[model samples]
Structures are given as C-alpha cells and as structure tokens.
Target chain A: MLSPEGREQIKYKARKFIFGSKDTEGVGKLAAVYLLLISIGFVYLYPVLYMISKSFMNLNDLLDTSINWIPSQMYLENYKQAFQSMDYWKTFRDSVVIAGIPTLINVVICAIVGYGFARYDFKGKKLCIGLLLFSFILPPQATMMPTYVFYTDIGLINSIKAFIVPAILGQGLKSQIFILIFFNFFRQIPKVLIEAAKIDGAGHFKIFRRIALPSAAPAILVVFLFSIVWYWNESYLTQLYVVGAFTSNAGGYHWSSLIVSLKNFENSYNTARSVAGSGMVDINESIEMAGTMLSILPLLIMYLVLQKQFVESVDRTGITGE
Target chain B: MKNGRKTKPGQLERRENAIGYLFILPWLIGILVLVLWPMVQSFGYSLNKIRLLPQGMAKLYVGFENYSQIFLKDPDFIMGLESYLLETLIAVPVIVAFSLIIAMLLNQKISCRGIFRMIFFLPIIIASGPVMQQLADQEAASIPMMNVTMIEQLLDEYLPHVLAVSITSVFSNMITLLWYSGVQILIFLAALQKIDTSLYEAAKMDGGSKWECFWKITLPTVKPMILLNVVYTVIFMSNNEQNALIVLIYDTMLSATGGYGYASAMAWLYSVIESAIVIFFAVLIMGRKDVYERRARKYQRELKREKRLEKKIRKRGERNERNYAKQKAKQQRKGANKKSA
Candidate 1:
C-alpha cells in the first residue's frame, strides 16, 4: 500500500519520538527539583539579602523604592558616615566596658551557683531551684521599673554600675539565666570527680575552680557569647536610661535616638543641604541607610562569625532541657 | 507537711551547708540588692501613683488605683489583650500545620535536606535579639502581598476577617512563627524517624496506598508531637509583647509619666492569662487517648483484604478497557477495507 520513501519516513519519525522521551523526562525532573529548591532558598535568604542591600544604600534611596536589592551605583561613603554618626569609637568603647564587666561577673557568679545547684544537697534545694525557674519566667518588663527605682534608690542609675550589678548577681532578670548553662554543664560532669576532689580535702572553692570550672568550659563559652550579645543589643534599656541622662546633661536639645533621630535628620538635611528648590536632601537617604547599616554591623558581623557555636548550643541542649 | 519534726544535723552536713551558702553568696547578695527589694518596691509602686525623680522619692501610695486604672479604666489594655488573642488564634494553627508539612517534606529522601533545615532555622536566629529589626523591616514589606488579587478572590468572599487579620500583626507574626517552626520540625523529625519502619513495611506489604498509610500509621505515632507543637506555638505567639506591652511601655517611658506602673500591671495580668492558656491546652492534650490505639486484629484483616481486592479490580479494569478499545479500532479498520474493496 505504501512506497519505500513513505515507509522509511514513518519509521524515522517513530525512532525520533522514542529517543526524545528519555532526555525530556530527565530534564523535566531536574527542572522541577531546581525550581523547588530555588523558591524555598529564596524565601529563607531574602531577609539577609535585603539587609545587605539596604546597608549599602544611602538613607533617601532606601525609602525611594519598595526595595533596592541592587543599587544602580554603590555608595561606599555610608559606612564612613555611620562610623562618625554613632560616635562609633565612644559607643564601641562604652559597649565593651558595659558588656564585658557583667559577662565576667556572670561567669563567676553563675559558675558557683550552678555548681551548688548541680552538686550539693541543701536545705532549700527544691525551693531554690523552683524559685530560679520562677525568676526565669518572670517577664523582665514587669521588673524593669522596680529594678530602675531600686537602682536609683541605691545611687546606681546611669552608670556602668547600673548594668553590672544585676549581671554580677545572676539576677539581671532578662529571660536568660546564665546559671542555666552552669546548671546543665555542671550536671554533666561525673559527680564522682567532684566527690573525689572533695574527699581529698579540696574545699568547695578549690574544687569549683580546679575541677568543675574547667569541665564546664563549653557552657561557659556559650554563656559568655550570649551575654555579650545580650548586653550589646540592650538598646531599649540603654536608650531609656542613657539617652535621657545624656541629653539632660547637655541642657539645650532633648536629643532623641536615631529611631527618632531619623525624622530630625530628614528635616535638617532637607532644609540645609538641598540646593534651591530640589525639595529633598541630596544625601539624606544615604545617611539614614548608612546609619541603620552602621548601627547593626557589629551585631551582624559577630553573628556571622559565631553562628556555629550559637546554633550548636541550641541544637545540643534544646535550651530548656534540665 | 512534716516540717514539725526537726532532725539534728551532723558536723559534716553542717559544714557542707555552710560551704554551699558561701558558694552561692554572690547570687544571694545580688538577688537581695538588685532583684528582690526592687521587685517588692515595684509591687508597692503598682499600688501607688508615683512621681519619678532621679532620686528615690515616693510622693504618695494610692491603694490599688493604678491597678484599677489598667483593669477597669484603660481601654488600650483591653484592646491589647484582644489583639493578642486574635493573633494567637490565627497564627498557632497555621504554624502547626505548616511545620508538620515541612517536617514531612524534609523527611523525604532528598538531596540538600541540610540546606532546607538551615533555611528553616534562619528565622529563629532572626527572631531573637538585635537581628529582629531587619527581620521586622522585611516582614513589614511582605505585608501587601497578603492582599494579592488571586488570594483575595478565593478567600475574601468566604473569610472576610482573614484579610484584616492577615495584613497587620498576623502576617508578620506568622512569618516569625515560620522561622520558629525549625525547633518543632526537629522535634517532629525525631518523632517521625523513631516511628517503627516495620509498621510502614507491613502496610506496604498489605498493598496500602500512601495516603492510607499516612493517616492510619503516621498520624497516630506523631500525635504527641502535634500536641506539643500546638502548645509551644500558642505560648510563643502570646509572649510577643508588641500585642501586649511594648507600645504601652515605650510610649510611657518616652513620655516619662506614671505609665510604667500601669504597664507593669498589664504585663502581670497578661502573663497570668498566657500561663493559664498554655496549662489548659497542655492538660487537655495529654489527657486525650483516642489517638493512641494500635491496629486491632479484625481491622488489620479487613484492610489487607480491601487492598488486595482494590489491586485485583484495578488490573482487571485496565485490561478490559484496553481490549475494548482494540476491538473498536479493528472494526473501524474492517469498515475502511470494505469501502476500499
């Protein structure tokens, strides 16, 4: 019924169709897998990407669009300006002083208390442990005003003393108890090690230092890292106490924070820096964006570098595990 | 109950007591000086209307007036409580459902599971501390997408409250909740993996469909985790102070008025409510038992027989359909040949 040319054409078409099926199916699966991964990854990474983008833009540019992930031209000067704006050196110095002293105190006090909780049987052991958990749950806000009043009553307000005293006592009243880490890590050490040291005539202090403290180094490290981050990021309390005190001392301007400072900057910069009737400040956006970038840089850098330990602690201990 | 009987302490035990007290002295001293006395004073302050100077001067103690003002008079406190309830109501179920599905997906034998886990955990890192500000900004920007035309068209007519709820606090909080789902996922992952593979193998051997196996085997095994996730998500949602105390406290602090005392009262009240909610649901879930039954002998036999019948019917139906189609085609070919002849 068919000529040789027609028959050959039909066979050729059939062979071509059959060969394409395998490659097409493989490519289809790969595409779907790629699409799925990319979408989920994008959603997860979007915020960090946004932070990086905003950090580079000038303040005005930040508000000009919904988002500017890629700036047409990068302005490297925002970083320079943020350093100057925050009085970066002074803030950094003050931050280190405030955060460091408390952390040292927290480590020492928490290590001892945690050891007591872990190793010894005392009269109020159950009650004391219960109270510690109670303190943990007590929202810091509930206590902040009283704590403030208490500090003022004792002449501890507006100084590094204000931050350090609570921290030193393991009573900072933040959600975290540095002692929890002490409790966990201490509990893990073979009780016999401490018992053996005690029986050999090492007193409590000697045993805690020579045996328990060294055994709990990882927890100590974890707590130190957490405490430093806590003290550094404590902008609210710092703002509440420090901002009012410093502004009042200056006598004229009631300087608000950058959260509030942004509005002032816009008004001042627009009026002074704008070239006749341009109606917008030349670099206002740049400054604001740069300010936000600068304020958060120390935190971001520290987080990026130490996220491994930070996450490791949470993964291992479940945070609330006794 | 037995406190009346006083036992004599041995010398070694007394010595241990003295050593223990000495070791914990710094914390005791700190708590006395810093936490306790101030907390007591604040409770008194909550009862009074105070003027705050940099110095410790309390002008007057008006009994329970500050507490009354927050509980009886302040509309914002009430509104804040309602908003918190609304957020918890909307966000908790979504988080439970979303996380369980995600845990299931992660449990699949897929490449790059670690990457998915890390991505899921990224939000948690953002949830705490200074990193919150950037996360907050991104959350704000993502707000408008909740009002997408297609989503609106589908759900708007049916669930009008969804729009209002989703746009404001609910959407951002859901995003925050999504990050926190990592912990739940990890917990669920542990639960899922612990599930006896033999149960699944037995189901497969009996020719159970994937859907049936999931409902009959997987759901029952992970029931406890599902309950845990729900309770944790609810607690986390309530503890977000934005819906509770942040705005009130911040405004008061900035204004430098007597708002701190009232805010403290509100915080105290809200925490009580939150703890009550968590405890209530926790008790409810742990007491329930319908979810825990293993397969009965009769049920197992019935399931196996049904699955075999389904398989047999499917094979026969496919063969019959193919044979009928081939017969129809052959008849068409014969008709064409008759026409040609």
Candidate 2:
C-alpha cells in the first residue's frame, strides 16, 4: 500500500541504522566490538574455567573423551584430599602471615620514601632516584645467595623476620614499582596545596600526614592490593628464606605457605599417600586441579569482593600517564 | 630545577633538604645495607668456593673460575639460557601487542566494560608460579578449541625453525602470556583514556580516516607508554618465579655439587643478561621522539635558523661597509700622493 518513494526512504533508514552514518556509530561496529571482546574474554578466562570444571570431574569423567567441559557429577573428594595433603589450615595461616606483615610495612615505608623523592630536593636526589629505578631491573636472583647468608648471619633465615626486615627497610617485593607509583601520584598534588598547609605553621611530617597522605587513598589501595598479591604469590623466595626448604635450618622453625605447598603437592601427596593405606586412590588431574584451585581460592575471593575498587584504582593511579 | 636556574642553598633550603633526607632515611639505609651491601657481598661470593659450615660459611677464593665454569663447562645453563632467551624474545612483544589492542578495544564506547576488564584482569590475582604450573600441567593453559598444531605448522612453513619453535611454545602457553598483560592493559587504557576526544573530532574534520587517526594520533600519543610496557614486560618475564633460570639458580644454591659461590656466579650472569634485555627494549622504543615533540623541535629549529640567517646578513653588511671605507681611504690617499708628486 506504500508509494515507491516512501518504501525507498524506509529501506534507506533501516540500512543507515545498521551500517552507520558519518557522525554516528552503527550497530555493525558495536556488534563487531562485542564479538571481538567476547571471544578474547573467553580465551582469557578459559584456563580458570577449565581449572574449575576439571576439579569437579571424577576419574571416569576425566578419562572419557566424550566429556569436554561438563562433568558427570560433582566430586568433592578431590577437595578433601587436596585439603589434607596441603595441611590447609596451617599453610593458610603461614601464607597470611608471610604475605600480610610485609605488605603493611612495605606500604608505609615506600610511601614515606616516595613522598620524600616527590617533594624534596637533596644533595644526591638524582643519584638516589636513578638507583631506585635501577633496582627494579636488577634481578633478585643476583642477590639471593648473599642475602640468604646475610639473613642467616642476622638470625632471620628461618623466621618471618626474613620477609619483615627487608620490608621495613623499604626493599620488599616490587617495592621499587610501588615507590614509583607513589612518586608519580604524589607529584600530581599541586604545590600550592602543600604551600597552603605549610603557611599554617605545620611541620613537614604533619603536612605529609594531614594533607598529602589523606588524598592518596587510590594509590594506597592499589599498592596495598598489589603488595599483598605479589607477596602471596611469591613461593620461591618464601621457600628459600622463610620455609627452610633445605631442612638444615628447619630445627625449631616450621613455616610453610599455601603456594609452596601446592608447588610441592605431588611429593607431599605421595608422602601422605604412603602414610595412609593403599586404600587411597592414586593422584589424578582432578585432585591436582583441586589443589591449584584451593591455592588461588583466597585471592579469587578477594578480587571478586574488591574488584570494583581494584579496576577503578588504575585510572586514578596515573600508572601510565606519568 | 626551577626555571632552569641553580639557586644557592639558603638556610631554609638546607633545612628542607635535611628534612627530606630524614623522611627517606629508612629507604636509604635499606638500599645501602639490604641491596648495595649484598651486591658487594654477592660479588665476593662469586669469586670464592664457599662451604656451608654449621656455624658459618667458609670461603676459599677462586677468582673467575665459577664464571668460566658457567660459560664453558655447564651445559644445563647454556641450554636453559638459550630457551629462556628465545621464549622471552617471543613472549614480550606478543604480550605487549595484545595488551595494546585490548586497551584500544576497551577504550571504545561499549557496554559492560567493567565486567570485561575484570575478566581480563582476573589472572593477576591468581597467577602465581605454582598455580600456573598446576594449570599448565592439566593442559588448561591453552584454549581447548584452538588447533595450535595447525598454527605451528603454518608458522613452520613460513618462518625459520628456531623462531617457529619459540612461536609454537608461545602458542602452547598463550593464555599465560596473555594473563601477564593485565597490568599492561590497565596502563595502556589509562593513557588512551587521557587522550582528548576533541583531537579525534579535529582529525575527523580534517578528512582523516579512523585508521589514519589511529596511526597518526593515537599511536604517537601512546608511544612512551609502549616503552614503559616493554620494560615492564621484560622485567616481569625475566623475574617471574616460573623462569627456569631462577629455579636453576635456586637449585644450584642448594645442590651439594654447586655451592652458593657457583650459584652466585650464575645469578650474576643471568642478571646481566636480564639487564641487557631491558636496555635493548628501552633503547629500541625510547630512541625516537614523539611526533608532536619532533614537530615542535622542527619549528624551534626553523626559528633559530631564521635568526641566525638575519644575524649573518647583518654581519656581512657591516663587513662590506668597512671594506668600502677602506677602499675609499686608499683612493683618497692615492690621489693625495699624485698631488704631492
């Protein structure tokens, strides 16, 4: 019933809505973006998903080639075995302490040092700053042996002090990066703000505490989270320094972390398997996946809870622009 | 640094400097004792054959024997170093490039961007060495649907063998490599978000296509960030506990055959190589100036050149006048001599 001209106009409008015009985004582009993001996002989360699904599959389901993702049934035995083998409660306690105390010290010390570099001029500030960045590139492996010896000499080899001492001294895990982040962040604080505070007869420490530190919530949060994560993830150093993996220094000190236990899970599980009777099932992929899941479970929960803040922190962190 | 002038230190300036030092005193001492002193001690350790006594370490100096042993004698280190270098060379670029692409994509006007970002960044919270190892063992590090072998074969047909092998290795563990780029994506996103929307509009007004604007504007603005990401990627790849060389060093440190001395030497060598990689990337990316910076420099140079030309012309005119005066004086003197004659 429509005229030919009216039909053509309607067709053109529909095409424009889909294909887009010069000044507006079309549905086509949006669809393409979503498609790309969705595919890549799937690839990104594929490992975690695979880990989760595999952890629930029983031996029969895992051996079946027909089963790709979905398991025949939920299996909680993997978690139970992994829990016992890892000594979950004890190792979890150790991980918390090992990652917690140093993170706190690192945040405080790095902030103070970063603030000093940002706001002050000293005789050798440039040299100090250069060294600060240079340290980031210098591998911790380069200093591992001597540092181990030094810790041994100072009676910190097999204790939590091994981690805390370096942290208190502003040399914790990735502390250089944290300091740089703080430096970049605090630099953006207008000079006038500090000047205004100073004119009120406040001391330098008072000014930093009351003025500069208060507005730095975003950087502090980012550093705190990053520090905790890095410390928690660090198993090699933890074993070498605090856990006394070599057994020579394990006389009075008994420290183990969750990640370290996961790393040595096979050996520990074998040991546990021998101690238990032959009734115990042989270790399989499901149980191994379950152990991996348990190790990362805490961090995954933390991320889920604090994700909004964590994602937004990068924007205000000025990590790239500076 | 103020106004590019060096002012004399007043009493207040000196006092402020002291206060600044006080604020940073903990870090300064920390670096000196924990970092610098250990560095010196490690170098000393590398020169010796150390024995771990129950009470203390006994040292017998061996000069560069440990170094020579690493270069000439140790086969495990050489092979590990080769594979490490090969994998890292392939991995860093792939990670950084993927991160930049994702950053640009996320920068676009999209729905549920927060969820997408969280998905991308979830690995950072969980990707410890042990966890990664476990996932890798379960064959979870690769996409189930991806025919990695097809890609490997495709690469082999086109690329050199060693290169193809490393690329295939990268493909095999592609998810882990991609996971490593979470912070990098955040960094690039921050930079991309800071870019003014008005600039893109201006480019559009100038008849620039989206591709051209991306190449000409977006890239140039984020050039510094590329270098930052490269350096970060290099450091992360080298220092990650998953690295075989680090594990090798740790094992060497504890092994009965190779004592702390040999391990120290190996670590120093590895650290040197690591620093070289970082420097190489830094120089490769940092060598070029920004497009805007180059243009500004060109304008400044042109202005300086014009002033220099004006000054040269003025000087030439004055010199010509002086010559002319001298010639006129000479002619006048010649005429006076003729009159005297």
Candidate 3:
C-alpha cells in the first residue's frame, strides 16, 4: 500500500526514533540515574561496612560517640573478644553438625525426589508432590509446637536429630523446591538421548545417577545453595529445641548456638549497664554491634564467593529472562 | 486415556518404582516420622488443650472452642492478622518497585557493574544470623540514641495513634528492610539480562524515546518476571518473623486465650488471604492480552512518525548552519584582501 519513497521515509523515521538523541540528551539522563544508583548503593552497603569497621575497634573505641568512619587505632580486641567470649570453635562445630548434616541430607534427598518427579510417571506421584507442597506452605512456627512434643516423646529432643530429621524427610527443603525449574529442565532433555541410553539396557537408576543428576547439576547446585543458606540461617526451630542445650553452659562459651548466644549477649549487655549512675553507661550498643559483626562475617564471605553460581543458576532457571 | 491403558506399569516398572521409593527413603522416613506424624499429632493437640506439668495434668478436648476463642474472644488475633496483612501488602510493592529500578540500573554496561551488583546482593547473604542481630541492635539503639523523643513530642502534640503507630514503625523499620531488597534485586537483574538488546534497537528505529522504550518494550518483556517477583515478595514478606507474626504467635501461645490449635487456624487463615491476594493481582494483570498489544502498537506508530520528522529537521538545520559558516569565512577573506590592496 506504500510507495518506495513512503517506505524509505518510514525506514528513516524508525531509525531516527531509536538511535536519535540517545547520545546527547541520554547522557544527562544516564548521569542522573547513575547518581541515584550510587546513592542507593551507598545506603545498601553502609550498614555492613559500618559493622566490619566496628568489628576491628576495641570495646572502648566502639563506645565512643563521635562515630568516625575510620578507627583511631586498629583494635583487634573485638575479634579476639568474639573468639574467646563465644567459644567460636565449639559453636562453629555445632553449627557444622546442625547445619551441615541437614544440608547434606537435603542435597541427596532433594536430588532423588526432584529426579523422580522430573523423569518418572507413577501412581500417587502427583498426589505426593501436591501434599508435600501443601505441608511446605504451612508456616514452620505453627508446626513447631507440635513437632516439639513429637520429638520429646520420641526422645530426639535436645539433639541434632531434631534438626536433621525434618531435613532428611525433605520437610525443611520447602524454600528450595525449584519445582518448576526442575520440571521444565527435565522435560527439555532430548527424548532421543534418554531413549538411546535406555536402548543400551541402562537401568533408570544408572541413567539418573550418570545422566540426569549430572545434567541437573546446575539446578542442583542452585538448590544446594538455597538449602544450605536456609538450614544455616534457621533460628526459630533451633532456638526452641536447643534452649536447654545452652542452659547447661555459662559465660557465653556456648557459642555453638550462635543465635542463642547472641540473645544472651544482648541480655547481658542490657543488664550490665548501671541505670542509676551519674553518667549511665551504654556499652550495650557496642557489644550488640560486636555480636552482630561476628555473626554475619562468615555468611558475607560465603555469599560474596558463591554469587557467581547464584547468578548462573538464575539464568539457567529463566528466573530473570523469560 | 489410550496411553494410560496401553502402557500400564509392569514388573520392571514395579521394580523401578520400588527402587525409586528406596532411593527416596531418606525423605520418606523423615517426613513420616518428623513432619506428617507431627502434623497429625499437632492436630490432635490442637483439638485438646494440654496444660503443662506446672498447670496440672489435665487434657481437655474443647472441640472448636480454641478456634472460637481466637476468632471471637481474643482481641489481638484479628488486629494482628490485619496489621500483618497490611504490612505485607505495603512492603511487597515498595520492595518490588525499588528492586526493579535497581536491577535495571545494575544491568547496564556501566563501570563497576559487578561491584554494584555485589553491593546489592550482599544483603541477601547476611540477611540471617549475625547480620540480622546487628541490624536489629542498631535499630533498637537508634530509638534512644537518635533521640526520637523530639519527634515523638511533635507527634504527640499533633498526629493520631494510627499515624504514629503505622508511620513511625514503618520509618523506623525501613533501615533494616533495605537489606531485604537484595533477593528481589538479584531476580530483577537476572530478568533484565535476559531481555534481547535488539528490542531496544528496534524501538530506537521507531523513534521511541527512552521513556517510550521502557513502557512499550521493556515492561511487557518483563511482565512474567514481575509476577514471579510479586509472588516471591509476598511469600517472603508474609513469612518474615519481624512482621509481627512471631510476636502474635508467641503472645497467643503463651497466653490462655490461644494455643497450638488457634495458631494453626490463624496460619491457615493468613495463608488463604495471602494466596487470594496473589491470585487476584495475577489475574488482574495478565487477564488482558488486547490491552498490552494495543499499547505496544500505539507506541511504535507514534515513535516512528516523530523519529522521521526529527531526522529531517535536524539534517536540514545542520546543512544550513554549515553553509552559513562557509559564506561568513569567504567574505572575511575577501575583506582582508581588499584592505591589503
């Protein structure tokens, strides 16, 4: 319906529209955006940076009111204090036993369960998944009281079993299901490749162990990170079951339960202050800050390192793109 | 139906199924003992109120009394639920919007993009454990150290409790929530990177402004992702203990007004409400393909026309300016020669 001249005009118009004013006017806009972005970056980063700086300051420097961004001196006492005061090794060991065992179980349990859901068709398979998810949606807090009673009756209370049992059963893996991603990825596996493996008389287990698991490695890794982070960070259930575990020890040496120890430190800091003094001491502020600093360092390091796998998984899962 | 009957599971299939079940025994055993059984036992506990050893050994099955007490008698249940929902609704949108904008900026091929991303992503890593403790401590310390008493005096003199309660808490808690945006930011970055750059080029060809490109091309491409973000945000926000669900649960569980049964009812009720909100919004946005198509088409046409006109004008102006400059230079040269002679 259009003439050559008209078509050419249209093409020219389109080209100008897209690439037009992008260089000059766009620079001002981009600069403003960058300024906004940098400000936000500063806001997001300041708290963690402040904590890291504070961690290096001694008890006295931390208590100072001037709030200098840099310390007057590089005080390593806080780090030493955190290590000695919290029984770092015992807590770290306990964290490993409580957080690690479950993470391992989650990876293995989820792999088999996720693989089965992905590659198989059987009776009640759909029902099992639906029910599993239903259980997942129910808040852990609601389930906690009942689980406590159940575990107490079974004599699994106050032990690592209480934590790992749920993880082993895939109960605690709720947050890391990656159900849709797994389903879509499994479906996309070339039917021919699977069939060829089958024709060679390979059992489903062999095929899964050799082929499916390796292929789902990226997704598995994503799930692995998700499960580990979740299990490591859990406090509510851990606090409920492990309250007794801490009362047996004193003087913050029971750092194996970091969450509980942090709470204890907060309580102690608040109680230690003399409210009736001519100048009331507020050392609680610095001690609280110290506890926080000590608590987050490992997680920060872990996240900074594994951010690559996290991003790559995001791409593979189409979480961002489509 | 045909496939179902024709490929009925045989002995090999049965064996494979057995092996599959065996492989998944870890979860099966765990779920049976730890989760399902506990849940069932919880249900039993919920129907009957069990006073601890301190309160004397008496288990009374009050039927639906606990649920009724929570719904009718307990004043905090309704208020707690309402406030929690309201807070979640407020936070989800705010965080999602904030994250989307940041993700877009971070996705650009700018300087220190990876570092910037790290800055944003760092929050998620430290969202739990010591980081949370530190953040909460700082927030608590700020209440007294920052001397909010001055502002509190001002508020007491003027603003009502509703504003004081909602606005003050929201403002005070915001510093801590800045960290919460990390997950959504990562997701948005991932979504932004997936968008084909050629779409922007095409929009450029049509004479679309940056604003127009965002609306016509960028927004639509990322619609599904927006939904995903919303879902994740709602779920996370609802589950956050800081949102007062923890406090409410603790208060109820500690008091005689509510217990395990009541908590379960409240949780189920809250979940339903959350799911409904998610579904409602999802349907509202994705319900109309025609609306999206129309907007895209209108934007493309408008852009194309303006781009053409602007191009023609700019070209002519540039040509005229160049000619004028050339003439002025020639006249100056002539005048210099005449003066020299």
Tell me, what's the RMSD of every candidate?
17.2, 4.3, 18.3
Off by over 4 Å in 1: A1-38, A57-68, A173-177, A242-287, A318-322, B1-18, B53-58, B92-169, B172-174, B179-244, B253-264, B281-341
lDDT of 2 by residue, A124-234 (tens): 999999999888889998888888878887899888999999998889999999999899888999999999988999989999999989988899999999999999999
- Return the top candidate by DockQ: 2
DockQ of each: 0.21, 0.78, 0.27
- Model 3: CA > 4 A from native: A1-20, A23-25, A56-67, A123-129, A173-181, A242-255, A268-283, A319-322, B1-41, B54-57, B140-169, B251-290, B293-341
Q: In terms of lDDT, which candidate is strongest?
A: 2
- Give the CA lDDT, 0 to 100, for residue B263 in model 1: 53
Worst 10 residues of 1 chain A by lDDT: A254-263
TM-score of 2: 0.92
Arranged by lDDT with the best first, the candidates are 2, 3, 1
lDDT of 1 by residue, B1-341 (tens): 57765656686676676677776777777666655676676676666666656564455767777778876877877777776666676677777777777767767666777666666655543444234543464453243345555554555567766456554444545455566565577656656777788898798788886678888888877777788677767655554433345557556633555455665565566667776666766677666554334346557789999999999999999999999999989999999999998
Q: Cα lDDT of all candidates, in order?
A: 0.63, 0.90, 0.66
Q: Please list, in the order the candidates appear, how each scores on TM-score for chain B only.
A: 0.65, 0.89, 0.66
**Residue B198 error for model 3, in Å?**
2.7
Per-residue lDDT for B1-341 in model 3, tens only?
Answer: 65654545586667566665665566566667666676666666667776656553357888876667767886776787777766666667777888888888887767877778777777666676445656665653122234455656667668776555554555456545567887777777777777788988887887888888887777888788787777777766666655576657755655565655666555545656766777766786677454478878899999999999999999999999999999988999999999998
RMSD of 1: 17.2
Top TM-score: which candidate number?
2
